[model samples]
Target: MKTKKLVMIPGPTPVVRSIQEQMGRETAAFGDPDFVRDFTSLLDDLKSLWKTTGEVFVVAGTGTLGMEMAVANSLRAGDRALVVSHGYFGDRFSELCSRRGIEVDVLASEWGRIVPLEQIERALASKNYQAITVTHVDTSTGVCAPVAEIGQLLRRFPDTLYIVDGVCATAAEPEYVDDMGIDILLTGSQKAFGVPPGLAILWAGPKALARRASLGTIPDYYIDFDKWLPIMHEPAKYFATPAVNLVWALKEAVRLIKEEGLENRYARHRRTARAMQAALEALGFRVLAEADHRAVTLSNLIYPSGADDAAFRRLLAEEGVMVAGGLAAYAGRMFRLGHMGNIDAHDLVATLAAIERAAVRSGIPVELGAGLAVLQRELVRAAG
Candidate 1:
């Protein structure tokens, strides 16, 4: 019998069968009546999902496009923006802004740790920035930023637009845009939305919309929020062709999320992450993220001294589990595992068992049942 493969990577997480079925249906025209209804409802449901009254844009692109849409429309070239970076993905904001001729200033924390709020306060005090970008969860280091506190802190600087990169956060994390004062929250469909890639979803608040209006006719055309605005107002209207089937899939994904209840979904992710993290530690694999500042969506785990990163991952794959390798400087030293979306305890139990088998097969000296034992107890504790 062949072992069933499970994609345990940081992104493009395992999509549930119901959501996957939506993607498999016959493709529909972007302007079809039913599609228009579904698209419009998805926009509305996303607003409710994030507790925002902002304009939501579901474009047919990658998460990077969502990031570009933020800086391209909101700020004119030569404007200054501040990037609060916890890891690589957070640091990417600086590059995105810089490419647009925006003067970018980055406050980057050491890998695996988050930048403190006081430092951000000091940065804001020193500069008159047009916008500030923070990654809610940096995919590379698995560090989760205190976005609510950061958003609360931004209230003092009313003129500065607050942009949050929620590519790896979004539905899995508590991102209440109106309450948190987030002007822009951007994410990709592949992560936590429990859908396949190719959609760039973003919610732009009134302030961000105003900022775009203030700086009308930005240089870029593709990601210009103004161009997307008319289409967003009426989903049946077209600017660029929308991903019709993906939109269908996303609507189904949202429906699943709604049925689960946002609070319960968040709690479930927390429990799952806690369980997996504790199990990894028990297996002698240290998490790259700081214990107090870990991301609930995923874990970036550092290898034990004697284990070969490639061999471990290969063995894990042989055991029918797939995960991603580290990026940038941390490459080959760690592996990333996603535990978000509509995953259950059984999935995680199997993953832990795979890891246990992989570790033992690789001569890592971990007791076969140790990680699984810890995972069960930690999950129960986290839940109770």
Candidate 2:
């Protein structure tokens, strides 16, 4: 019997059967009544997911577009923005700000760890930034930033907008956008949304909109909220051709999330990640992220001294399991395993088993069945 393949990357994660089936259906015309209804429903669902009653935009692009949209519409040239970076994505935010001619002040944290809340507080206390961007989960190192505290801290700087990159943490993490005082929360369809990668979903609170209103001109035309706001207000209107099939699939994905219940879904991801970490540690693989700072969506593991990263990953691939390589400075030194959206304990069991087999093949010692046993035990304990 042939073994089925599994994609365990952090992005473009495993899609549920229902969502995949929705994508295969006949595409709807842009102005079709059914399409408009579904599109409008998706926007509403996105607002609910973000826990914000503000404006939501579903752009036909990737998470990067969502990031840019937050910056482009809210901050004009010469505006000072503070970037809180823990990893590569954080650096990307600063780069995006630079491209727009916005002055950026970066308070970078050590990779694989959360940015210290005190550092953010100090930055805000000293500078009157117009906008502040933080990655809720930095994909590069699986580090979960303390967005809640950061959001609370931003209250002191009431004029500063809080932009959170939730690409990897959105539904996988417990995020209450309005409660946290987030001015903008952005995520992509491929990560925790359990859908395909064409949609950029973002919500902007009233403060962010007011800041945009104050701006003289926004250079980026396609991502300008002003152009898309009317279309969002009237679903029948068109700013640009939307991805109809993706929109349909997104609605189904949101329905599945709703059926699962957001709280339960977040707990499942946490359980899966905890089990994965326990099992990997039992296998002698050191985790790169600290215990408290780890993300429920993904885990970054440092390869053992004797193991060859390439060969180990290749072996896992041969066993029908796929994982992501490291990014930026940690490239080739570690590996990333995604446990978010549509992933379950059984999937992690299979993944850990594959890792055991791969480690043994890579000349790394591993007691037979050790990793799987730990994974099972951890999962059961988590469930209890």
Candidate 3:
């Protein structure tokens, strides 16, 4: 039997060997002066990456932790919020609002569809919402929302804080958040950051900070911005026992990103996504998202009629390639291909080839060379 290498499914995307080795170093005490310095530097790097002049908060928790913190600190009981829902994460935000006793007016779009800017404008015009929540990219359906347009609409409601979930959007596509005027942007390390799960980074603009200050009682002790901000600003004191190893890996990842420059990193992601989409379409699989709204990181492709989706995934795994099944409403109907995080044309070609083999093994007759040929054409176009 041949040894199998792991292909990332959705996220906790493949961490590079250099970063992994850094994470394995001997642990340092939380109070060590050097650790505090490194932690502070990481926070600075995070702000630079997000391209925000706001205070960046790093917490030892998952992406949802940042969402919860943003919600708790920004909204008091009886506060009204407008949540734009198009997929799983959007619905999750609505649920979070309900849990926190915040009154919510939800504007929902069909799955795999972008929320209309007109609807968002109407929602803002109709109510005095304290905040508005929108997911920059929906990981479930591979749909990228028009965040900039939404931001423009929010200008009508200038006092309403705009919160964006950039978990799948961050390093994959940074301009959408910063250029769009998102007031609060949050993301986790496991997705585009190429690191293990366990840290969440939140960027809060001045408005978000002001809202936090206005709320007299701290929303939650663990995630209170007031408590964490002073410590983050002080060079000598650290907030929580920082995740030393993960912080080391994050710093290296940010270093690589800075070295590559943001525009080039975004271009790489767009190129890889275009190649994958071209190949899959050539293979007779329909793309779940409309061309204009498709995300740069992952592409959701519908299974061919009469094909068994689960068996197709099993066959691919047997061939040493791993892809993910759809979630919730899309389950058994679609499979997602992730092309983010250090993936390039060569890696995409390999995955497409594996898919070709898997299709044949699953008894679906596929024309040889079609997928790869389409992929090559796109790659050539990208290079030009």
Candidate 4:
């Protein structure tokens, strides 16, 4: 059983040893002074990472819970929500809202394309929504939404809370809470945060908090922001016992991110995505995303003509590399390769070689060394 394969999927990216060491520490009580201090610092660092002074919730849940929290806290049943969707996850937001008895209007585009700003404005003009949600980058399609532009458009609608699902984008993508006029930004730790999955982090700005306040007595209990507010302000007081180890791991992850500098890290992610996408192209695969809208955190590459999706992936796994299969309608037709979170040039080179080998073994036509040649050149250009 050969098991040292590279984990190249979009989430739970390779956790560096330092973060693992933090997670491996002895468990501490929620009220322990040391744990409280660490939790408090983690909250502050989260605010720093998102570039906002808003209140953030770090709870034991997945990104879905974060979405539920954002919805349950900010808007009520019968309220209207505008869901701007790029792909699968965007549609998930629509489902979340509709299940809450909220009237949902979805502005969706083709998998690889983003909804034009004019269409979003037209939708806004036609209806009055209490909350509008956008997926920063829909992993299913590898499409990055125009969040900053959407934020700018949202300025005109001050009453609508702007909620961004950063499950696949946070830490790797640009998500400025205050500057982007975002009311709630939710994400999971597994994706770009470079930590094992467990934490669901959500940032609530003043507007979001005020909205929650206005809804005196919400329906939910576990996912409500009201219950977590006091705990966030004073970690010593506990509403629920925190995920102590994952919190520590997240703190260390944030520390590494800070040390590398956000701008540098973001640039590195861009370079990684670029090199992978270029290599895949040289190997005769087409990127699922449009050129301008491709996600920097990951790439969804369409299989070349006559390529066998399962065989290639299986062979790639045998070659000590793993990648994600496409979601929803594109299943069996595309593969999603993650490039974010603690991955480096060597990992990229190994994955590239494995990809080419797997494709060749799967009986897919390819020029030998063609993909690696382009990948090496890109790496050198990035280095120099």
Q: State TM-scores per candidate.
A: 0.98, 0.97, 0.96, 0.98
Model 4 shows how many backbone clashes?
A: 0
Give the range where candidate 3 is weakest over 10 consecutive residues by summed lDDT. 173-182
Write down the TM-score for model 3: 0.96
Q: Which stretches of candidate 1 lie over 4 Å from their true place?
A: 380-384
Best by TM-score: 4
In order, what lDDT does every prediction score? 0.89, 0.88, 0.83, 0.91
Ranking by TM-score: 4, 1, 2, 3
Off by over 4 Å in 2: 382-384
For candidate 1, write residues 234-261 as lDDT tens digits. Answer: 9888899988889999999999988999
- Clashes within 3 Å, all models in order: 0, 0, 0, 0
In the range 280-370, model 2's lDDT, one tens digit per residue, is: 8888888888889899999999887867889989988888789999988878889999888987766788888888898898787888699
Residue pairs with backbone atoms closer than 3 Å in model 2 (clashes): none
